[model samples]
Target: MKRVDVAYVLLVDEHEENVLLVKNKGPGASYYTLPGGAVERGETLEEAAIREVKEETGLDVQLGGIFSVGEAFFEERGHHTIFFTFTGKIIGGEINISLPEEIEEVTWMNLQQAEPYIHISNEFEGAIDSKTTVPYMLRDAGRYRS
Candidate 1:
């Protein structure tokens, strides 16, 4: 099976009550998710996290400690993916959808406001419910990392 690694940044608003999320406009089911993307070759998890946040949201961020890790599998896609999420502090830039083709909107949302829009996954859903930390589900699988 194919293997992939992705990193996401969880950035909270100044009030610490909201998180930055992306509304994607891709094929299949579209949904709002944390700002992040795939880790390119030679890129570390932290580097990917920062880069993805900037690319997706047009916001510069300082990555903090790792909050959680998860894995998923996609039988239809025939791939395996590992996901790592880290805390992030927005250092600059306004909220913008850097890539219009892939991203529809970028916004900060509290858990209650986001629950309906977010696509539920075993890995990150718990993080949203708790509102304080991300959960780790590092198991083998074949899928895209969220």
Candidate 2:
């Protein structure tokens, strides 16, 4: 399987009561996720995170500590993906979707109201609540492959 590296961020408000999320335009438009994407070649994890957030949500962010590192292998896609998530603070720029076709909406939500839309990390259940969320990473992902 081809290896893919993905980077994401958890952008929290100064009060820590809200989060910035994006609703993708395609199949999963209904569900909301943190603003981030895949890491490009030669780009550092932090660079990718900053670039993705700008592209997806039009926000400039100041990244904090590494929040988590994980891997997910998808047999169907023939992909082994390594993901990294970091805590980020919005430094500037207005919130908007640069790629309308790929991203439908960008909005800030009350942490309490975002629970249902956020995908929680199972391995880190304690860290997977509404107030703090990491993208859902698959487990034993490619086991079905023969």
Candidate 3:
């Protein structure tokens, strides 16, 4: 059976129309994205989001609500990730890049500006434009290959 991992993608507030994004450092370093990580064994998705935000960016964020849920699979990498997208309110903490291994720099971009930088998954693209809360399931075509 394939392993499944749960994670959150946080849209951190930056004033009115903008949100904070983090540039990833390692493998998927080319794209800019939200603060998130895998959900730990004993923690809930919400708890993981809060913990990941603080650990990665040194920011305290109050999760406003869940925006969407989606599955991402990279066949060549042999990984499948389930993502929970959430809207977060920045309550406190200075913007600091704490996780050097996973993140490069932190940036604040308006929602419109962020469109170009985002690595689009059909799930994410739909959620951004839709009014309904949708759960997306993505499967790798090579999931059963050896």
Candidate 4:
């Protein structure tokens, strides 16, 4: 079975007090997630991360090291998905839902405050609950295979 590659960006405030999250469009309007999507053909992972953020959040980002990873297998669909969440910082543009069809709103909140709002997946369990967030908490180099 072929695997799908997806990229996600975690943008935090410079003061390290807040994290930028995008309110996803679709069921549970209250739920939030990072700005990202599946990698497009011919686009490198880093390029995809930057593009996804700009497309979904209307913000330019400078992606940092890999922050965390999540994997899921859809047996019914006969496909597997690997999620690569990366740390990033806003470098340009302002808050806006570039693609309202895919996003609802853009907002920022500290990790603790974001915990309840985020229901992305079980793999992201301790991301906000951990006291060791930021400062390279889960950062590592990302390897891209073509």
lDDT of 2 by residue, 22-133 (tens): 9887674366878888988867777899999999988899887766677888999999998787888888999877798888888889876664444545554546343444
Model 2 ranges off by over 4 Å: 28-30, 112-118, 126-146
For all predicted structures, in order, the TM-scores are 0.78, 0.78, 0.74, 0.75
Overall lDDT per candidate, in order of appearance: 0.77, 0.77, 0.69, 0.76
Show where candidate 4 strays beyond 4 Å. 27-30, 75-77, 116-146
Query: Could you list the CA RMSD of all candidates, in the order they appear?
Result: 6.9, 8.4, 8.1, 5.1
Compose the digit string of candidate 1's lDDT tens values, residues 9-57. 8787878678788988868967887888899996667778888998998
What is candidate 2's CA lDDT for residue 1?
92
| Residues 66-130 of candidate 4: C-alpha lDDT, one tens digit per residue | 77667889898787999887788888998777787778788888877775544445665766534
Ranking of models by TM-score: 1, 2, 4, 3
Q: Give model 3's TM-score versus the native structure.
A: 0.74
Candidate 2 is scored at a TM of 0.78
Task: For model 1, state the Cα shift of residue 20 in Å.
Answer: 0.7
Regions more than 4 Å wrong, model 1: 113-146
